[model samples]
Target: MLTVDFDRLGVKPGDRAIDIGAGAGRHSFELYRRGADVTAFDRSADDMKAVAEMFAAMELEGEVPADARACAEVGDALELPYADETFDVVLISEVLEHVPQDVRAIEELTRVLKPGGVAAITVPRWFPEKICWALSDAYHEVEGGHIRIYKADELAAKLTAAGLTIRGRDHAHALHAPYWWLKCAVGVDNDDNVLTKAYHKLLVWDLMHKPWLTRSLESVLDPVMGKSVVFYVEKPVVPVAAR
Candidate 1:
């Protein structure tokens, strides 16, 4: 499922798009399907390999448009390999909170986006994340788990300071918030817990079936308690003077 709405971000066919920290390449795959020239970059060698394999599979199946191109790269978020103004669109979803130098990562993202290019950044929302932290330290203590929680304003402010003009913000995945809470309460690794198992099944069903009732419910509840807060931004034509 997509946390950032590509339509709202104004992503178009033939756009050069980068999915930073593309864990399983969800956003990258979507961009490719939309006829973008897509790149999925992450530090994990395994993830990059998997993303490459998926890309190859898509190519064999003719899943992407003939004009769409895609590839995977292993790279750091703080020092992306691409040159400045390289991409027309960028997506950094559910990743900043895991980066210790999040501002630097933001700078890297902004540096690579072409003038007037848009980006979508998603992070765990503060309140629900705070509750999870209160309930279980393990939620934030793991090697690559979330190191920070972001209030919407704080994130937007950071992006603005890094040279992006924040355009819009929204919450997403409301139905999935309870899944994380349950995981934290039981055990982050304990997928066998009965309640967790049941919830997982429901989530799987929701993702696959997408019943209208649940979709409408999630649309209503997303603004209030969604787990991820997504912000849309554009790199201005001219960089603002550093304060």
Candidate 2:
């Protein structure tokens, strides 16, 4: 299931797109399928290796346009391995809350995006995540888990400070919020719990089939309790100072 909406992100054929902290290449694969020259960057070597293999598999399956290109690179989000103004689109989905220096990471993302380019950044919405934290210490206290919780305004302000203008914002994955609450209530690692297992099956079925009932329900619920909040922002064609 995708968090950031690519149509809203203004993806186009041949766009130079990068997915920063692309954990499982979900967005990167979508970008490639849409004919963008895609880069899937992450901090994990093993993840990147798997992503690269998937890219090749996709190519073999003719999943991407022949002209579209993709590669996976393992790197630090703090110091992106690209020159300034390099990518036409940038995505950092469900990643910022994990970073200790989120503002600095935002600066790095902003720096690499071409002027007038758009980006989609997402993070766990405050209340749902807060519930998870309250329910279980194991949820956010673990390594590589969330280091902080971002209030919507706080995150938007930081992006503005990095010279990005917020174009739009949205909330998504409303159904997943309750599932996480369930997990936190039981044990984050407890797949053995009957209720948790049942919920997982439901979620998996929803992902695979995407039947209309669940989709309609999610659409109605998304604005209320979406697990992730997405922000669409753009760099000004003329520098913000110039205007």
Candidate 3:
């Protein structure tokens, strides 16, 4: 499911977009569909390979518009491969919490965005994430899972320090919060638990079909118990004199 709202992020056709730490190319795929020059980058070779295959499939199936381009790159988030100011838009969703040097990661993300370009960042919301951690140590204490919980103000301050101006912020995926709570309550990896399994099935169905009731409920609940917190920020454009 999409985390950051592309409309709020102001992504337009022909925009050069980078999805950093892209696990399965969800945002990148959407960008391509919207006629962006899209790059899906992640540290996992398998994910990159899968994303590339999907990009090829989309091209062959004519899923993306003619003007759009898409590619996958395997790379480290702390050090992106592209040169400075390379992208018009950058999306880093549910990624910074896993990085040890989160400040450096933000720096890398900021460094690659062009002047006046926007970045959409999403992280596990503080309350739900804190509840998950409190419910099960295994939820976040494990490798490659969330290493930190961020307050909205803390994240905003970090972005501001990195020279990005916050434009808007919101919460998303409220419907998914209970599913995670169920998992944490049962066991972090307990896929076979009856309740967890049932919840997973419901989540899968919701994602695929998006029934109206759940959609409406989530829209209302999203501002409160949403599992993810999204922030839209932009690099300031310097006038010639300021430059």
Model 2 ranges with Cα > 4 A deviation:
239-243
lDDT of candidate 1 over 113-201, digit per residue (tens)? 99999999999999889889988998889889888888888998999999899899999999899988989899888978999999989
TM-score against native, each model: 0.96, 0.98, 0.98
**CA lDDT, candidate 1, residue 96:** 96
- List model 2 lDDT by residue over 129-222, tens digit each: 9999999999999899999988999999999999999999999999999999999999999989999999999999999999999999999999
Q: Whole-model lDDT for model 3 versus the true structure?
A: 0.93
Q: Per-residue alpha-carbon lDDT of model 3 for 112-133, expressed as tens digits? A: 9999999999999999998899
The residue pairs in collision within model 1 are none
Once fitted onto the true fold, the runs of candidate 1 whose alpha carbons sit more than 4 angstroms away are 239-243
By lDDT, the best candidate is 2
Pairs clashing within candidate 3: none
